[model samples]
Target: MIDAGSSGSRVHVYRFNYCKEEPQLEEEVLFHMIKPGLSSYKDDPVAAAHSLDDLMTRAVKMVPEELQYCTPIAVKATAGLRLLGKDLSDKILNQVRSHLTENYPFPISANDGIQIMEGSDEGVYAWITVNYLLGKLKPSQRGNSAAIFDLGGASTQIVFEPVFSTPSEKMSDGDHHYRLDYGKGDPYSLYQHSYLGFGLNEARKHIKERMVDQWMDDAIKTGRVYHPCLPANHNETISYTSKATTTTNSQPEPIDIQLIGTGAGATQCRAVIEKLFGKDRPCPTSPCAFDGVYQPPLTDTFKLRDLYVFSYFFDLTQPLGMPLEFSVAEFGALTSHVCDGTADDLLKHVPGAWTSLQSAPDTCLDLTYAYSLLKTGYDMAPERLVKTAQKIGGVETGWCLGASIAMLDGNQLCKA
Candidate 1:
């Protein structure tokens, strides 16, 4: 299955066994080279909409037709959807919707007679990934409680969920062992949230609006694009620690986020963590616990990795007069040359080899670009974000598995 995301898209070939009740991985790869996200619409959405046809054509080429497994294929679009105006969105949807029906045998389409979701879909995916990380998806498992905070190029979401161990907990069947209630929290207290901000572009806008003079100063000196600022000191870190959770509050605890996801600039996050600890959080010295990363979504599996993502969210700023190609996925540099936000920037990760954006050698740190946007003008962090991600997972890939559940029936309904 292939999902078109806000930045690019990905294709995965997978199989599952109902008897074993688990999905066995087959093959997967991220096809970011196509860059088929709605971000393309930023310049000329109408033209971008048309361009999707080309992207789809490329997507068609990525999959191998000879695979014989009868897997249910799906195509999902995330954060990027909201970027397009209705006219452009509708046009793009209509075109892609047609392809959904025509391509990949049993193509998964969110348009047509289908529906798309927000937090719920992502929540379910987090459930699966967390299960995989926790090694808890036994046939006798019910579910788990988690807070998901996902930041994407187009949108961001915070999901809250209380997992029910046994899928058939209330069923009158004798297979009662198929239910699981792990050591997390109270079951049946699921919740979630979604925010349009917290993305690279918007976060950048926030930084620029808040530090216009600083950005212009950089532009004048460098005469180049200095994207995504990086945090230079510890005082600038932003705390993702949650203030509440169902376990801690009478009103479902309202999940307080203890983790923040980088989504793009995890490598930078490692730097922040190291600078704070004055030690290499990841490998070379010793993995801080975040090394040997997974599909990027399964970050929770690592312990003590509480502050890895959020390279730009802290509003960090860089000194003018630096390299030209240095880029960041927003969330960089602090409001002041020195950051006062220690709790906001940090996230969980076992110290290890961090992943960088676009892995090419040319891209360095880009907190300055984001700072310029923020100093200019844009929305701040979305409301009720931390809580939502608790239920759902961060937005990257695999959110579809959740969407396949929560948003399927317009509510949370597990697919048998």
Candidate 2:
């Protein structure tokens, strides 16, 4: 299975045992990623489909020659393609289908196998991946599953099985509620939602757009805008194309804006990041996350349940020498320390800080956004503990493994 994500495309090869009622994942044979995701080649769908050539070639070699023909192949594009609008996404998917059909021996699982995935499925599948790897999905482990928070490039998702006090205290009918029956145990009534334009990269873009808008007059006067989230003395250029104009038949015009860093640190940057949550928007539900999205109150529904964060959350925190689990309050403290200190200070105090900053100057901004996302957006308690992991038992974590399991079970159950 190929996860055609916003930032890149990743292929996961797995071998499973069907001795038991539920398939047992024996091992992940190979997990590889190729950069510059299909969405990057918006103007060249052929190039986007071809980007998976190397990864596909590797996958073919991993399977035995006799088994290759029967092995199921699927490509599930995420928020990146959804953002491209239906027309472009459909075109690119068509090319991907042609490329896979003509080049690979593996059979496409279904007619709609090579297509963009729904955001809700993206969240639930990832939830499955984490819980399954942790062994919480087994029949013996019912009611012990953890909630998942995935922060990708173009989107972010939250999924959890809420624990209610009474059988009558049920979730309201809405898009946020999903009933998942994996044929492993009792069906899970999960709370899941995906926020578009809220992933690490897309959030950065949205935040930068707000910064440019707020300081446009200054930019017009000085030819540069001051960005508080960036490191001191940092300089960068970002492009902005209005979402309103993107879907029109005519090509959208993009504006280039240069930024100068102010080194405002975490405290100040958190305030800026919080604004992007759209807290002021009207909420149809009594309690909602930012942008008026419906969500069961985390404090009550998910009390004492383990929480796991993935994607950029793990990628950023692991380099900082963080433990496998830490309180949200501890994360806040770390964010402040990193944001207030300089690269030289980091080199002296934190082992990998300097190198990380050198490669990604937006470290401070990323942390600030993450912290705010947990505290303000999700209303997570500062003292609540959350786990982060890129891999478990030598297998990479995300939506792919769970997606593969769903595919093996049957395509209809995995449908949007």
Candidate 3:
């Protein structure tokens, strides 16, 4: 399985055992990534498809030659391509399909095999990956399953099996609700939604644009704008791009300017990030998350279920002395230390994160955004315990494994 994400493209080659009713993931034969994702070559679809050659070659070698003819291959592009709109994304997908079909020994389904994955399916697949890895999909662990919060470059997703108290209670009809049977047990009624523009990288771009809008005149005059989200002594040139698109174009040239850091801490940075949520928008449906999107109350629906947060959530926290499991309040405190302190202060308090801060000065903003995203955006409780991990057991944590299972179950490639 190939995950063509916003920041990069990753390939996961798996060898599964089909002895059980459900396919058992024996081992992840190969896992590799290439940067500047397929979307980077927006002007040239061929190059975008060609970018996977190295990774594909490596993956092909992982499967035994005898089984190559029976193995199936697929490419699923995420928000990166989704943001490119249909015309351009389709071109990239077609090129990718042609490349794989013509060269690889692996089987590639003519339809619905290599394409841009729907946001809803990405979330559901990731939910399955986490739960299955933790052994929560077994019949004995039915009610003890966990929820998932995935934060990517261009989008964020939340998914969980909401426990309804009354038989009459039903999740309101919308894109946020998903029902599925993992094939081992009864179908699950899950609450899932993918927020398109609320991802960490996308949020940074939105914040930069807002800052430029507020400080444009001053920046143009002095060539230096003060930004509160960055740490002190951190200065850099950043692009503030507009989301507006014309009939022929999806990404417009950005407005670039020099930014000087003020290190004002999480208070002001949180305020800036909060405004993007559209919290004030009128919600026709009750119990809404940010941007007037419907959500079953997290507190009640997912009361005792464990919450597994990965990707950006794990990347930002683990280096700062945060444990695998921590409460919302603990995360907030770490955000404060990172956002409010300087380079020297970081060396004194969070020495391990100092080097990372220097490389990415917007560490403060990233940390603050993550904390606020959970505390304010999702409205999670201060005491809520969430686990962060890049891997579960020996397998890397993401949606690829689960997607492989789905394909095998459909008899797409696996004959067992």
Task: Tell me the lDDT of model 2 at 365.
Answer: 93
* Cα displacement (Å) at residue 352, model 1: 14
Instruction: Name the lDDT value of residue 174 in candidate 1.
Output: 27
* lDDT (Cα) of model 2: 0.86
Residue by residue across 1-416, what tens digits does model 3's lDDT show?
Answer: 99999999999998898887888888998999989899999999999999999889998888888788888887989999999999999999999989988988888844478888888999999999999999999888887889999999999999888887888877899878788877656798888999998889999878866777787667656657778897776778876554431235665655567887788888988888788888889888888888898888888788988999989999998777789999999998888877777434645565666677667777888888888889888889999999999999889888888787787754445455
User: Cα lDDT of all candidates, in order?
Assistant: 0.36, 0.86, 0.85
Backbone clash total, candidate 2: 0
Give the clash total for candidate 1. Answer: 109
Model 3 scores worst on lDDT over the 10 consecutive residues at 240-249
| Each candidate structure's count of clashing pairs | 109, 0, 0
Error of 3 at 295 (Å): 0.4
lDDT winner: 2
For model 2, residues 29-98, the per-residue Cα lDDT tens digits are 9998989899998999999889999999999899888778778889999999999999999999999999
Which is the better candidate, 1 or 2, if ranked by TM-score?
Answer: 2
The digit string of per-residue lDDT tens for model 1 on 242-346 reads 223235344443211111122224243333322221222333321221221111122222212211122223212212222222222223332222122232323
